[model samples]
Target: MGGRFGSPLFGASIKGFLNDRSALEGITSFGSFGIGITGLYEYHLYLPGVPGLRPFLGGGAHVATGRASAYNPYADSQFSDIYAGLDGVTGVEYVFEDIPLALSIDVLPVLNFPGRIGLWWNAGVSVRYVFK
Candidate 1:
């Protein structure tokens, strides 16, 4: 589990490797206003000299439902909103040797529409416990 806080978002995520260089992630996030779910496919590049360090780029989509506190000008706080968006992520992850832990720093840019077109970006740091 990790905190991907663009706007104080707390969520849990599961990551699985598809091959040596590709991975997938499912993320569920919640805030005071609502909840969001996202899926991403990433391609990782390992550095030649840096062990356990990889940088990745990915894109996916998200579906969210909730009320807007102030983030969306179109949605009122009293009502709930259901929207979908496209997401792009780029980050670096480091896995510790002899420890089942990974640390990541990433940025996500999202575009949401149907209600309105909203484009924004967020950066966050996360610590993940890896289960083997």
Candidate 2:
């Protein structure tokens, strides 16, 4: 009865910081900011006989939004717009037996219209709790 569990789990995280498209495009004339949230289902992918460490993978969709602004001295005004998009994520995680914690890194590639396709990555420490 210890192979893989069939249930749903919930978790949350805060990102340290993010790199904006303006920097990637080499456009210093504009300023931008971005943040994201995600929900996913976990599926075990390791051998059941293993005891110390376990590895798993997850897939989900996330919605992110950002704002960009550009200044124009000739027009005597600043141009700004807010944009949002949805992205897909897939990554692996590792859980240690000695502690009730897990660590993972995921690559989230998004398709944004009126903009360019870019990849956003997130890596952080996480804690896992079992509920029955």
Candidate 3:
């Protein structure tokens, strides 16, 4: 679910997470999973032409689906009914001068829409090889 798109300015990825109900809750017996995709643009930040730490800003979209059931004092359920959201990201990347390999870390703020309005932050790290 991760790979570079042959360009330093642009990259794409898809990711997912899973959790078991026993781990999530002490009573319920259901599992859940979520998936999302993102595209990023890395701006060539200024540092006297240094290619070590290039900071960038970009945005993309995401879609996630999952549900968890609760059964302790009463029966209840929660779902990521939002389904989709817009993502804003800011990050810094470093490319090895002798090779086409790059590594980066980013923080993303998400805005979910429609009936399930919510905001959250996501942070990640990525490594890529430019095929230029």
Screening candidate 1 with a backbone cut-off below 3 angstroms (N, C-alpha, C), the clashing residue pairs are: none
- In terms of TM-score, the best-performing candidate is 1
Query: lDDT for every model?
Result: 0.80, 0.35, 0.48
Off by over 4 Å in 1: 1-6, 73-77
TM-score of every prediction relative to native: 0.89, 0.44, 0.61
Error of model 3, residue 127, in angstroms: 0.9
lDDT of 1 by residue, 32-130 (tens): 778889899989999999999999999999888878766554344568988888999999999898999888888889888668777867566767788
Candidate 2, TM-score vs. the true structure? 0.44
Cα error, candidate 1, residue 66 (Å): 1.8
Which candidate model has the greater TM-score, 1 or 3? Answer: 1
- Show model 2 residue runs off by greater than 4 Å: 1-32, 69-86, 113-132
Ranking by TM-score, best first?
A: 1, 3, 2
Residues forming the 10-long window of minimal summed lDDT in candidate 1:
69-78
